[model samples]
Target: MSAEHHPRDRRTARVGLVLFLLTAVLYVATAGYQRVHIDVLSADVGAWRIAATGEPSIDGLDTSSINRSRVDLFSTVHDGRTVIARSPGVVAAGVPAYALRQWVTDAGPDAEDFTTVPPTVTAALLTALSVLLMWGALLRLTTRRRATAAALVFALATPVWSVAADGMWTHTLTVLGVSGMAFGAARDRWLLVGLFGGIAVWGRPHMALVAAALALTCAWVRRRPGIVARVAAVGATLTAGASLWSYWLYGRWSPSGGYAPAPYLSRGAGAQYEFNQTLGGLLRNEAAMWLSLDRGILVWTPVVVVLLPLLVQTWRSQPAWTRALFLAGVGYTLFQGAVAPFHGGDGIYGYRHGLEFLACATPALVVATARVGRRTRVVLTVVIGVQLAAFSLGGVLNRPTLSFRHHWNDNAFVSGLRDVPLLWAWVAISVALVLLLSRMFLREGAREA
Candidate 1:
């Protein structure tokens, strides 16, 4: 609040704003760079949006549902070329209804030929708000300037980078919900926290795991009666929000699907066995690939770097709620990993499902990076630099599509393209420079800490 601190505060604000802008620009560039295509997940949502609203398809292609039941469900509900069953349910109830309705009434070009403009604009706005909320939460947990930098780094991190540019998805929405809850807890705004958590569940039911974890952590910590009551209020609110959609889509009392058998649970004789054999199923079906990729980046390597240890050593080490929230994140991923039907199918880009795990780990990773000694931090940064360089270069050269059909050994990277030595070299150099700068930044952060 003093004059001496004014310049420092201004600088911090500028840095945070710059990071936010960078994220926004990146999404805009990608959205405008290519026409919307059905190859991506969010694009499918766009297609449904168009169909539901009585608009012609962007590419005039109708999607196929393999089973008769699904087709009937879709047809009965999707009469207007839009999805009538589930999505409409969300729009009709809870927070999403508010956001979606607001989106539809706003005058704008139908960028994707559906009711909503291209997800890029809408999602970018959402992602920016999410990141800003994260900054606020971090500020509550630490110094304003340090929290700003940490949050900025988190916004630019790979998990977020992929989601924001790829357009709207449940993850972007979840990010906002999670950040809101985090900020609300920091400020003791229980009801506001409940609202965000509720919205998150409306977006993705899986977030119930996060809410449960927060509640349990609150209880375990012996929080004040009022605070504990408030946390429970958040969980109840989220459950109520999600229930509105689930009941409409499922026509059942339980939308969380706990009462119903999992689709995988009925697929074969093993179906019944699968649910009970959680860890065993994951080991046999998903773990080998999951662990291998986890080792590659975003998990093992970052932990080995000075960051985790540095985070422990920091004067402002994470509190009980923060640690519990992280544990819940881990538990959620593990629970899903154990139960998800993993038959080595089409949706597995370097294990795309793991992105959820990465999101939870990101804040910890940044905090850890901020806590290390300069020399050790430089070493760790170099390691991250190498990995990111590999990832980005591999991305560009291969024009790699993010999906499970293409695995590490698949040589899908530019498999059909003519080899160009000059272009290849240029991309490599660019990747290297980015990594190098990242390393330097980490080293500088270590010294400053």
Candidate 2:
């Protein structure tokens, strides 16, 4: 912000832009519908339909292009006619891409399929921007050199690539929101934190607690009630707006809308959902989220291992708002893990539920990046090397069908390696490359220090 940092900051911005383009291309290229086409496909249909017609329901259109089931259970609900059910944010977010796809393809208003690049590109671009914002967040608490290293790991080696970038899932929007929170909270920009906090809820309704955590923690830590009040005002406006949108689309005040199987909570819909948390389910699921190879956050993102040793020190080192942000991530993870379907569905490579925790930990991780030893760097590189090879084989280059067709207990990365000979080669080459890069990073960090 000062004159002393202007040149370097601009350089960092340029570097981030380059990374943005590179990441976007990879994300879009590797994206495939697999079993999740309807997720974003419905969004495109909804946005396009809204543009051409006033009606929200796709009653007359042929929806076979997206392979939408004639009577799918969760994705849609029947009132009088079938609706292409999706979260309000998901539908709204894809409007620009749907428009662009239509313009470039010269498609008519009647067209239902949006393709060439899947409409999920909206999620991809947003996730890429989060990487740049992550770099900025790191710079707030650490040197540029450390910030770049951590941001690169975030982009390439984390679930931002394997899970969020795979499709237009909630993880895409949720990561973006939390990344904004990290950027704002690190600098005590209460309003920015609050604004993104509200947006995070739109990404996933359960994430309402995230904004609540940030607001209350900021109030408690900074003890600036007036500024925190501004945070609440901005966040409340967005929250109210999203609720209105939900009601208009879903015809109910409930955030879950018509997604539930039952008509209402009074009629046994509560049985389908678990408000009464099982102690065993909570303990088992939460532990598995961090420790299990099948869908553990650490397994997919071993780079976070470095943060473990530094959490306490960095917790002491960071400001109150930052610490509060990380604690909020902890609470978010626990609550989500408690209520989510066991071990998450058997569709993805890593644990999508753990993303916010990783995002919120950025400040502590950035502070800790400076302290990691060279041996630890190479060792972490080795862990990441195997992870990249596994993810590329299982997640990007192909879908995680082994888990889907068989069971969630199966590790998609391991299955990818076992079934594909090419992945063995990928592991051989990538491990060497990451090791070489680790040495270069070590030298650069030493010179900068």
Candidate 3:
């Protein structure tokens, strides 16, 4: 049946719109409260703004007015001139906002103390829209309420909240693209699936794994012939365009020209040499990524720990495409941990490198947990409460930086929550509310059953 004829699809889109608006408002309010501007967290936004002003290289641009440390984020071109080393897709994405900021300020995009509000808020809106798309995808396989719940968890309990709301980081755009790809795939919108997938790859080369997985799933698992051709066409076109731009900027067709020392060498010979000692070292890093309290995945969002079991339980019942998407998330996470130079994503909170997987696989997780027993659902709710508490408190208290060691200790839980009595009170309230909601939902589900 067509999506237009499905009542669930209509409801899902409506709920998605509400969630999107709520997310946008929350992000904008937070940005305002924080008095956000182009800071280190959004150095790329600043770089893009400069690029929008027609300056290809920031080599001689006076950055003294801005945070000098942000300049370090850019890459030195082959000619020894400093340039934004990251992909231009993000810069291109922010052009509309940059233009708006210029008009608002009535000054050059390079004006000192120029506000980053436009681009930052634009990024947040994009993220909210992505979350909406993810919710719509979840709705295809689960109840509307369950899909709404998943969207809430994604927007509130995950790093998606902190990271996307902060600025136009590459991950922010990548999440939007990935979520759109998943939504399109769920609805058999092959063209949109390929389009968003290609956009994601353009935003972050590593996301090619996700794009390829989606394309292959449609072609092999779903047996959709046209999907492969569409994906390849879009992917090839974007990659070729990006390559040409890279050649112009770096004199080589390298997309990662900005990440100096190259990804492989960035971690230095000690780590690379030790990792080559055996595959064990790579596995150890992956384990550490999930188990290390300092920056571990579960340590930051314990709800995911609960979701894992639920996901495994519902594996057999899931659609082949959903299963493929879940594997894609796992593959991307493993790939990032094993190969990426910055395993933890350096400056963000809570395994930012894994945000794409976490956000993209959320629909699969919601579907997996939809039929879980009441007790299990209650437990999941509590875990989500704790995750929300941690994310909320940490976002407010922790210093936003590349390294957390300075502000967080070996035990992030203790360090983050120890001294904040008000935050503890908030956590108590949040848990109680979660339990009440869980009971209501379980009762409602029982009545329907």
Candidate 4:
């Protein structure tokens, strides 16, 4: 029988379809009707333009058609010819969408006047599909309601929603790749797992950590020589292919492309780099990313705070292979935090890079919540409710400048806090409420235990 004809596969497909439709509608509604411009697309889309048209250089592409800093981010002057500085994975991902846009809209490649709505909508749909993949994976380990809730949290209550729904950033593709790997692991399909892991690394080189972690976990779990060899061989081939492509394009084998050399080497760069390289600075930034109201992950999605306790409980109950799979998120987090830029995601909604970790960790969270007590559930409900309200209010406050370009110094959340003093007061109150509820939930769990 074909794979799609399998009862489990059919049910998974139906669930995925429903989730994809729901998330796509929500994203379109939230985006409103504005013809928003996305700045990050310059690198991904510009590269797409070059590849699609068989042009080696983006020099004559209209300057206004791309992001203002297209030259700096997308391409560089290499021996008098322009060369794309970004990895090709994301650009390749956009090819089908770009082709469809051209076929349906009768649009020509006008590099100077690229619109954001079409590509942004395409990316949002892709992100919705990722949520579906994550939801399907969670179902293997939890009840239907709990799996749905986890998927919803990953899609709406977290930074993944805001960042991935907005534009064609590499992070959206990374989420899809991570979630696909999770789904493959849940189904015990080692080949699928290896393929998704390879795709993740193709999208973002750092994701190799996630891929390697998953590959090792599967090999250890099955303990079959044939499976282990197949997974290793496939993964190595895909990753090596990507590296070779990078070398061919930029004369370098770096996974991040040749945009900015020695990005991880902070030594002698400046005081910021010097501080970021220190262990003390790394820990400080990690704390700030989780707890600080300005751009912390928990600040935007207090519901995720439950994951800490859930992780502890789940770790004890889950098998060693399962634990290793979940730890991919932890490994990715440490790697990203250690080498991330000074501002951490440069002023997006929350810690955008962390969204990939959150995606990988969602299945474990679903399992953890499956058998929780009533008190824990109540606290989680309250936390989710509060997060929804906070995000709604933030949408109103930062409506005008909520796109890919607004990061770091130009972050919309920071600007909202500065413009509206009352927003800070509201945030403080919300933070306190979440903390109190979390404490209550932990105490209740402890008592029950």
Candidate 5:
């Protein structure tokens, strides 16, 4: 990297570097806080072993070992062969880690070595990189001060730490893809916009809508018809390749690579797969998502209740493409609410699905925060304090059960206060962050005034 001669730019660069290292360490250290999905935790090892030895099937391995939960990592295919649930995305990301693990353990698929507190080091690193990329994206649109703070919140106070960094969940790709979109759009790089959109689709087939929404909106807003073809073709090619591979592996063409049919626990009952699109139902899901204590954004990240209102207040002020991207995020979120429960899964920290919306509206958010009243700044500080405590509960807290999704609000606070060991650590960290951030923001606000 070239040296930045300007003092201000150099300072920003130094800050970004320090933040990267700090967040990276945080992610790696806390990775074991949550129990990852059985499939996500094991997919890396399974795929690596299969690809390394060029095995056509698992038939050569001990079938007796299937009882150990190792085999649940993959989907069975023809003639006893198997494929990782999400092809070429999550599986592909873990290839290097798998190689590293193999070198360390000197084991193969039959070894049945599995499970750990923090599933994979690589997963944590990827999530850290995602935060760094977000910081860089924010820098392109807003002042260094706001960008850094917003990125810090993105790294610590959000599900990026509690959920994505905890394991090899597919949300890892979602953050990466969304950050790529933010960066590409900010820089007016059409191919990047397309490539990352396609990558997001690979993470969650449902994200195909998000990718298309972003690409088309950008192209139309810019009045560049060629961009539509260029971006669309890129995303289309990627989605098609994944779909074809899905057909080969699971006799299905779904983007989730045959994992789409997996059991999804619904909060509102009718049927497991039911889509309740009524006005009342949609409104209810919207309210539940924003404020419900169990899985609500407010409960997990109170700062968002303050930060996210920027989406509406500053919508008209955002660039055309960014506004469209923000709206696309809203549409995708509502779609998620209609089709399934907003909890994402049984028990997780914060809102997993809100990750995409934040990524999409980051441009607008940065602008809205550029200038704020002192009262708003005070509220922001307190909420950031709450956010720090909420995500920090992961490592010190007990493993959350599937049913604990509903009980999360109660268990998290009550247990933390009651547990002697956790109380000091959790409260200390949060107090330190809130004080540190408050000083920085208040100092900056005074200078501006």
Candidate 6:
């Protein structure tokens, strides 16, 4: 086994390094260019505004404030009872608070004096970390070479990478948390896994399930009575400590602190409604709302198509225990979609609620895609290349507003690129990708005995 495995492992490592390098190039190119033109300080300026003030919440800063207003982090709400969490307010989690406090002491309410560089830099760094984690997780699941290819595809994935570069939402942080947990699990480092799980929840309350699921997995994996007991004790203790810290801030021990249901049943109910609700009933309506908000996916159908097969491959994988973690990631993301209001269909960046799942499922794409025949691999690569080119164009130039139109947010480069010539280009690119990816499906199916 090692004889065959050795070469494959080396190749995978090389692929992973290449993928990392490519991602770095894309990120630096985009962020550096963007910073020059748009003032890096002003990109996701709301987050910085929030950090400067002592707001412990972010509930109030919806997409409505996108281009219209500047959020004041230090301003008090009516009656001085509460502070908002948005452009003007900070969520006070982990390092953001300490950083903000120090800045305030050093600079004093200058509005422009907050720690701007670190957050944006951190956002970019998190993207790199997430990609690395995905690569590692995929490596654990498959041959080294295949894992590296998967990481490359994931890093360059149109939707995932595009969002990573924009640095608009908290989804990046959540991605880091989820990816970290996955890495921990694959390595059997329950303690580190538990720590990441805690961080994931800390980053976003709705993600609390990730940590809980890890804890359970730890117990099951180390099932001997003594080892199980020890794992459980350590896992529970870590989780409790993090939960307590959160509760201390929001007076509730939850990720979505204020929004979490009274008893937690509602959270489960929301997930069920999303998964099982009838097409003609509440579920359909919910889906429609999500679609409206996530128009980006609608506009970019290629990325959308990849999601189904990605899920299918995971569903068919062996070992019920292994599959449960993947399912939990899906369930939690779908739950977010069900419960979250249609901030445009779930909020700001199309399908924002499901971004969490996208992050978790992304590694699977690389693994599944790489396992295809050579010609098929070429086709898939072409398609992904086209998608990236299309997305980059859309991002860099004017494009017909595909999503978030209510906000008049249109900086997309594809607006002009979507003309007849570009349309044909997109079509050719897509056909090639589909052909390759289809071969991948056939190969995986053939092996499914």
Model 6: residue 375 alpha-carbon error in angstroms: 7.6
lDDT, candidate 6, equals 0.50
Q: Write the per-residue lDDT of candidate 6 for residues 1-449, one digit (tens) a residue.
A: 66967876676567667766777656645542232112122333434444544444334444333333343332223233343322211133224643655565754334345444445445555677778877787667775545554565555544455554445345566677777777866776655565665556545656667556545654665573343344445545655665564454445554443234543234345452343343444464345433542343433435435445554665555333245455667668556546544332211223344556666655554445534556555555565666655555433331333444442233233444444455667646755664565456444434421
Model 6 TM: 0.66
Candidate 2 at residue 222, lDDT? 65
Any residue pairs clashing in model 5, and if so which? none
* Candidate 3 lDDT, 1-449, residue by residue in tens: 98766885566566667898888887766542243323332444434456356655665555555444433444556676666566656655666776665666655645364555666777778888888888878868876777777788888787777666656777777888888887887888767777887677667777778878878876986677788888778876776776676676667775543443254534455553355235676677677666665566667777777778888888888876677777898888777776652244444555566787786677677777766777777788788887777666544433333343432235454554665556677778888887887667645634421
The TM-scores, one per candidate, come to 0.70, 0.87, 0.86, 0.80, 0.83, 0.66
- Candidate lDDT scores, in order, read 0.50, 0.68, 0.67, 0.64, 0.67, 0.50
For candidate 3, give the lDDT.
0.67
Per-model tally of clashing residue pairs:
8, 0, 2, 5, 0, 21
- What is candidate 1's lDDT per residue for 1-449, written digit by digit as tens? 67998886787677667767866665554442233222233333433444344332223333332111222222222223323233321233222432454467553224333332444466666677778777877776655555755665555434454443344545556677777777776676767766776666665567767766766666567555565577667667657755654454445544452124364335355564463355565564455334443222233234334465665675256665566566766676666555553322232222334444555554555555555666775565455443343344332231333344334334322332235445456445644664565555533335432
What value does the lDDT take at residue 366 in candidate 2? 66
Candidate with best lDDT: 2
Per-model C-alpha RMSD: 6.3, 3.3, 3.7, 6.1, 4.3, 7.5
TM-score, structure 4 vs. true:
0.80
* Number of the top-ranking candidate, with TM-score as the measure: 2
Q: What is the per-residue lDDT of model 4 for residues 16-72, given as tens digits with 9 covering 90 to 100?
A: 688889888877566422423233555455545653565546666665635553234
Local error of candidate 4 at residue 444 (angstroms)? 17
The alpha-carbon lDDT assigned to residue 155 of candidate 3 equals 82
| Candidate 3 stretches greater than 4 Å from native | 1-13, 32-52, 68-71, 78-80, 109-113, 260-281, 341-347, 395-413, 446-449
Model 2 residue 16 lDDT? 73
Task: Tell how far residue 436 is off in model 1, in angstroms.
Answer: 6.4
In model 2, pairs of residues that clash are none
